[model samples]
Target: MKHADIKMAAEALFNERHNPLGAFSLGSETHRAVTIPDAVRRCRWIAVDINASAFGLFFVSPSPERARLVPCFDSDYPGVAVSTKFISGSNGEEMVHHTRDSTEPRWWTDDGSAAMNAMFGKLAWTGPMAPLAPGTSGIAFPVHADRGQCGLVVFTGSEIILKQDLLYEVHARCFSLFAAVARIRPSDAGRAHTISKRELECLKLTANGHTSEQIARTLKLSVHTANQYLTQSTQKLNAVNRNQAVAKALRLGLID
Candidate 1:
């Protein structure tokens, strides 16, 4: 697909967040697990686990149909943890309490004030849903436990409000599944690749079949610089070539 096509696809996906290509019983361990084939035909699923000090990517949907959310990233990237920080980083406001106390999930968007926008806007993201970190729209469902330790946070790209009745089942089940496996007060999540913001944008466009020159025009960067981003992303993803990098990025939930 082309860049513009991908953008339109994302808008459609966002609008249709409550409607899946397939139906589900809404009684599954995770939101994505509720579906037999895939939850959202065009979207990918990511699980975020929170602990005492840091957050990490617990799972990325292995669906072949789901596109990479970003071009050169996965759970192994440091920015994943940073995203959590941005969400829970409010002054004197602990994150766990936000989930432990509330039964309902809360909605968040990166399209807030300039400060909020800059916080999530800088990270690497791609795909039709490539609303990058500083600006990705999602709902946070916190996992509460009686243990009084850290709570888990399950962040999904889906707006999730439209199907509140149905999606709540999936979200509650996700909490149980996450609580069971989560470590109490664990150490930091391991190292992840660090790709620049511009590199990610370039890689996403490139994945949409834009050549160096086309990417340069769209992004208003020089062709040489556009190619440079691809090369850098290729190196960071440790892929043999740009094609391999795209595939790896998708599997890693970096691009879509």
Candidate 2:
């Protein structure tokens, strides 16, 4: 999409934010579990809406002095590793340097300012360096978590359109999305917690598309018992639904 199309869509979204009966309810649904597929869909939708060619959600290590960029969900480049002192960096590369030496022309909000226009206006891309893409231009929303941990949700395209109101709306949505993902994310030390043996069995069965009755038949248990196990597994996984529970289990390697 062209920059003008991007600008027009952003402006519409910005205006919709103020509509009392607006249908955009992403910010209010953060309490739900966010599966990998769900996140990817949201990112893709946002990218298309804003005319971005790529979208990524990255976890920035809490250690500012030796920060690491862990790509959680990237449309263009998944699992790319990079390092930066995000707290002190002034330019793109200093802030976030990709492994292939791609320099990201980005805007930092670690300073706690919600004024995106002011922050964006300060960006100065000087000197010769590889763009994040062929002609990368994007916005990064920094999401701060507990204990100083943080992450970034970014949108990039060959030509990106930015408006202060639109950026603010996107930032709020990014924060909500990040929180939903964090709930299902495994602990830094590895698996956040464990499910019971029965719970695991039920979750695996669910992943295989087994209904409660089928699971009960397979396990030679009552349907009520099978459902109980599935419910317990869902609760233990911190998921809002069976599909989410199955997805989380698969991600944590608890089930194939």
Q: Give the candidate number with the greatest lDDT.
A: 2
Across 1-256, the per-residue lDDT of candidate 2 in tens digits comes to: 3322332453357446652223333344542567876876776766766676667776643322333455566774344423222222233334343311322234432323345335466544312232333323456655533333346676755445555555645655565566667666535403324466777788888889899999999999999999999888787767889999888766544565
lDDT (C-alpha, whole model) for all candidates: 0.42, 0.55
lDDT of candidate 1?
0.42
- lDDT (Cα, tens digit) per residue for candidate 1, span 59-88: 322223332211112232423445543442
Q: Which ten residues in a row have the lowest lDDT in candidate 2?
A: 81-90
Candidate 2, after superposition: displacement of residue 126 in Å? 17
The model with the greatest TM-score is 2
Candidate 1 similarity to native, TM-score = 0.32
